[model samples]
Target chain A: MNITLKQAEKIIAVAKEKSIEIDTKMNIAVVDAGANLVAFARMDGAWLGSLDISIKKAKTARYFDMNTGIIGELSQPGGPLFNIEHSNNGLITFPGGVPIKNAAGEIIGAIGVSGSSVENDHTVAEAGALAI
Target chain B: MNITLKQAEKIIAVAKEKSIEIDTKMNIAVVDAGANLVAFARMDGAWLGSLDISIKKAKTARYFDMNTGIIGELSQPGGPLFNIEHSNNGLITFPGGVPIKNAAGEIIGAIGVSGSSVENDHTVAEAGALAI
Candidate 1:
């Protein structure tokens, strides 16, 4: 199923709450099952540079069906997925991207966060995805 | 000021209503002032190929602050902007893209619509932008 605007807002709201909790502004993005952007938000003071990164992270997670941090680990210089990130016209494999699943355990979409450290980004992304 | 998720949803809703009035399915995209994606929707049965085009159209409109149809006219051979479509890594220099302005007349975002005739796409895009 595609992500409705309502669901997308829910994800963004959770991301915002998590960002506030961590005291870091963030750029949050949500993409549909087809990896098309569904919703996005750039918190005040969020880094402009990371806006597109948030979108790409969600795309990367959807494209591979895994968290970007895990993808980063697998894409290391001689690893199995070496150079895989380059395949999708550039991927942010470090962290902060997570696939979103429905109650049936089907992947419905994905959430991506940026404008913070990799660890914090991942945490925010996780909060959003789980809120779905 | 950025285009929040709430505003994006309002644009999408108006576009959907216009698409129905015109008897066509459509892919709609919205982007903030910085030309980054804010929200996107592909109505059921919309053409798959026009998905990314809708996003790019919004970006094109935001980049030049003009409707894509006007850009298309200027990009015609022998025109001042002939070949300009190829300048921004490929732009949709046709109809269906419009800049979105706030109540104060400040451009805050843009809307793009596709998956129908050029005329109908432009009509739908206009409806969305005006809804803002």
Candidate 2:
């Protein structure tokens, strides 16, 4: 299964809406099932560095098929997947990434949110992933 | 040690067919084991930004002898391969790049596709790689 350009745009729209509702500017990114970037948006005044992080977060979630927060936990020093962030160019193991699924309960893509606290980032990403 | 233009074209032809089958425009590139370009094709209305990405993806696949997606999973921040992309200009660790093999299962080259969803890109590239 995969995501379409229209679907990617919808994900971004919902994510942007969530960021506005929270009063936090954000960098949002969506990647299709293969973990390649499909769409991205950087809100005005958003942290520039976060633009890359947002995209990486989206890719990471799709690569592992799990939340980045859980990856963060598993990647802790001495943990099972420790040093995992060292793979895949660079992965964001913290919160803010969520998988997007289709009506068939199949993962179609993922959304990543940044430019705010990890909690806020996760919240925004969740909002976007639910759009479909 | 390398791929011929004829073979590269054949690969691209198959890839293009798959791309058309999936209804996605794509920029496709084929590279020999030396990480050198052998052939390329840009589907009508493919993403211009992905032109460079498609080439780099082919080179990255050849250099690593594995799907870029797998390399991505191993190169996160704390993973053993963190910063691997820094070598050889920059590697595209995401999907859509696949290694080509000959009848003896020997690595010959790689194919990369960009445009539409990563799922479609990879599907097209895989079809191309299998042609050889």
Candidate 3:
């Protein structure tokens, strides 16, 4: 199942409500199960940094069907195949990223965000997920 | 502050405790403030797909000062500057990525992961962070 446009909308709405006075800029990304782009957005005044990150998070979610944070640890030395972390396109492995799941508990897609405090970033994404 | 070798080691330890019998291979990435690679590792049997994504997520965390998940949302259309989502490095924009924060709450670096399920990836990363 693919992420519906409605779900995306709810995410946005929640973000708006949760946004703080930091006037933080954000980069958001949505991808399908195949790890392909479905929709993307960047807030005004958002940093140029989000460009690469948002996409990576979506790809991680799609490819692994898990959050990037967990992937980050397993990629470490003596963890598993630590060498593989640097082997490819150089995706990230950290927290502040989550997957988008449907009612059936199957991960249909994912969403990632950046450009604020880590706590705030997680809060916004969490809000989006809770909204959905 | 850069992520020390010891911190990377801790992240790996937490992952080992959290990993399940899914035999999930993981790709982990660590980066400094400039978004340059500090350390990278990929577990054996890990999917080849993580190479690019792990790097991108690190860059995202470094550049955005937040997590990849938050950046994902701002990349959407009608959100802010969605067009920029596709620009530069073709990085990902989704969850499963996070920034590494020091005790002062300042973002010193970041970590990103891929492979296995999204939840598992997040769990492992979270475990790493908590361990630190």
Candidate 4:
């Protein structure tokens, strides 16, 4: 139901540890049980565009309770209506987003990171999840 | 990254199979490589509130490359700024979202669903992810 501070630290630490010489800036977001925002972080020099996209990714995960990458597949030919990105609203459909669960496997919140390649983004996210 | 139509169909099929007597309506979203909308669907009686949340979740995933649930934690005390939900721009942070990855482990896109309880939303999203 709540996003603990401990989890956030873990995500940051993991990102720093895994970060390579790329010195890539990171943008992270956390959401609550109701799919609301709980916390957010943007590393210095991170892309400004990544800020909004990062937060949106977390919302996608919390709202859907699934991985954003999977959502991408559903938007293809013969998929659903395929109208997530162009909804006129602030909805975005992409990868690099994930969810967080408690010991009981209940989804309490989520995490999203940007400012890197999709693979790097996913790696950092996985590290954060495992840290928790 | 690329999300295929086959994956979307699988998600829908699995959701129908696992649905209980709740007769809950479902809203599904899919995104593409650029974190843009590709496909989307809403069940007959689904809640309208879920639509924006669902797509935002997908975008959050793509932007952050992590789960939305984890993002929630960083927004708490001493965490990140915790401003994702409150950002002037439209960014959602919640649960019931997921991501789709390619064989190379590249983040292709994401998926999000609404119109049910958090648990139900997650279940349906999970089913869709697994279908791929």
List iRMS (one decimal) for every candidate. Answer: 3.6, 13.7, 11.8, 13.2
Over all chains combined, what TM-score does candidate 4 have? Answer: 0.52
- Report residue A47 deviation for candidate 2 (angstroms): 0.2
Q: Per-residue lDDT for B42-111 in model 1, tens only? A: 7766887888899889999999998999999988989999998777687998999999998999888999
lDDT of 2 at B44: 50
Candidate with the greatest TM-score versus the true structure: 1
Q: Interface RMSD value for candidate 3, one decimal?
A: 11.8
lDDT of 4 by residue, B17-77 (tens): 5554456787778777677887788776454447777777677667777655455445444
Decreasing DockQ order of the candidates:
1, 3, 4, 2
TM-score for all predictions? 0.83, 0.55, 0.49, 0.52
Candidates in descending TM-score order: 1, 2, 4, 3
**DockQ scores of all models, one per candidate:** 0.32, 0.03, 0.08, 0.04
Index of the highest-DockQ prediction? 1
Model 3 bad stretches (over 4 Å)? A21-23, A81-83, B1-132
Best by lDDT: 1
The DockQ-based CAPRI class assigned to model 3 is incorrect
Docking class of 2: incorrect
- Which has the higher TM-score value, candidate number 1 or candidate number 2? 1
Candidate 3 residue-wise lDDT, A84-124, digit = tens: 33434556566556778888887777767677776676666
Evaluating just chain A, the predictions reach TM-scores of 0.96, 0.98, 0.82, 0.84
